[model samples]
Target: MASATVGVGWGWWGGAMRIPPFRTSLVVSGVLVAGLLLGGCGTGTAASEAGGGGETQGPCAASGGAVGAGAERDGVRVVGVVERAGAKESASPSGRVSERPGVSVTADSLPGVGAAGGPCAVQYDVTNPESEPFTYTITFSLVDEQGRAMSNVEETVASVGAGKTVRRTLEQAGHPAGGTLDAGRVRILDVERVPSDEAPAPAGSCPASGLRLTADQGDAAMGLRVVGLHLENCGDRAYSLEGYPVLQLLDAEHQPVDGIEVLRGTDGIPMAGGDDGPPRPVTLRPGERAVSGLAWRNTTEFGEAVTVPYVRVRAGAGADPVMVAPHLDLGTTGELGVRAWRKDETDPGAGEGGNGRPGAQGPYGGSSTS
Candidate 1:
């Protein structure tokens, strides 16, 4: 008997409240709302500090720490070391439902077809470190292997900024796919916040690669340093940078010096989806922006002590090709009197005409490689 049914809500405290994740093939149910202050009137303590109606104490019992209803009676707990969110954690994306305090969940990962696995991603950090301004709500859950029920995720606005420590992402979206669920059996990750007016939205980018590398360029030579990629199209439709980028040259011991003529193409045209050339298209109009740069040259030769030469980029489309390894002091870029010969021993246009000499075009008859 396996099952699935989940629904939990809290929109700034006003409406939407339906909680149920307590199944029974083995017993699994979850609920930890923090603002109604036990109002249906059960566990005592002036009905949870007048939250039952004498009013004025519900800020989780006026923040004075353990203010009633047994502090949490012993079951729900997953805040883990958030003493101020300042120690290491970063990764963000997927948005459109926010209210910062931090934490949201609706997880799932189970026997997942034989080896055991499912559920993960339980991170949180909001930061009102303690100057005042604070709001919260964080919920996350998952259950399988006889417990019957599987998920009950929840995220309802969060705001904590007096000292600043924002870092939060919760999307384990019903986990339970197989192959041992990829071996990480996440039981039930967590986070919750409450104090509302809903305000915490900013997470979603790569909007067509609008320049974001943050600093990591290292690979040198008189040329082979293409660290300039900036494009933004936000998406409503319109994008085509064509494609023909595969520049490689790594010698000075980094190896691979065989033949040297790696320019790809520029004036002789030929530069779109190459390997055979024929489908070159470039059009962008929907908030428009595009810029490109990549050039290489280091045939290797002249003193030959170059040491770890670099520059590797391969573009076939969109984005995902980066390898810049800079580190050369070769008499400061003259390639240090280079001399490592190959490609049949130079002179194909020595000063401009020698290799295939016929008015010079000696990088091997370029017309998309005739």
Candidate 2:
């Protein structure tokens, strides 16, 4: 079953009823990730220590807690709380007992190319809830769909005391010019507070190493290849995902060898899943993942020049999709560049230009490339 959808064409998202309303208050403050290793600070780090005194606290489920069927309408899931909304909630810092408050973090800009870039920024509203003097260890990192650590930078802030909110912004850097975000591995890593003096040392173990790519047999014949992608989820909740899925390819110079913006189906339609296709409305229970395959043609004369492919996949609820473009390396090969059939261009490449894969040509067809 294809997942239900509330499509809001690119560029124009807010005006449409399909697009729900969400506040963009992502606060972040840090430079491009530093040389910290990929592993997290481990579950035993001082930062992991909780101070709520292990009290039986109110329910804090993932953003997409299962609500009654009717609660989910128009692609937006409405969750209810046993108590009044916006009730006072207390979160302790490791073991310290001070009400040093920080501002809420909200997503300000998303990464992407061709109207989509892969880099995104989360802005923070740092506030101090306590009256005494205090400091905070502000950190940022990339987490995978399964809530595993990808990378991070451990930074600090001194003297952010009671009744104040400071702002910080976190950003994923080095994204290609234009691309999509990998929705499955949307990187909404963790952001929380820890007592500055007790900040834990960085962890250096990897949950999963780098991703890998493999192409079908037809890839060679059709001159098509899959590149890399930057994943992201715009929803308040995080998603879970598996597999090292990727996008189209690019040459060594970072020039896109395949200019295909979106993948089309056999009927010349673009969607992640459809009828008899991958399951649609794949609701990756919050903080989950959903992977999709991306393919593209050469679009140019094949030669000794090497090519790299990348994609900027993006996703978010009640917000415009955030795009990130990562790349793949394809060694040199011998083939002509791919020719994308314009809305009205003659066939001039190996695969048919209609949908998914290109079509087969008739044995005796006239040659026309105008």
Worst 10 residues of 2 by lDDT: 36-45
14, model 2: CA deviation in Å?
Answer: 41
Error of 2 at 26 (Å): 47
For candidate 2, the clash count comes to 91
Return the TM-score for each candidate structure: 0.21, 0.21
Q: For candidate 2, give the lDDT of residue 244.
A: 25
Across 1-370, the per-residue lDDT of candidate 2 in tens digits comes to 0011122211100111222211122122211111111111111101111121221212212122211211221111212112111211211111323334674332222212111112222222345555653344333333444555444433334455555544333222112212211222223232233232222212111112111111111212234443211222223553444322322344422245763333332222222112133323333332222223333444444554444432222222222221222233233432222211111121323332211111222211111121
lDDT by residue (tens digit), candidate 1, 225-288: 2222223344577555564544445553234544334434322222211233333444555544
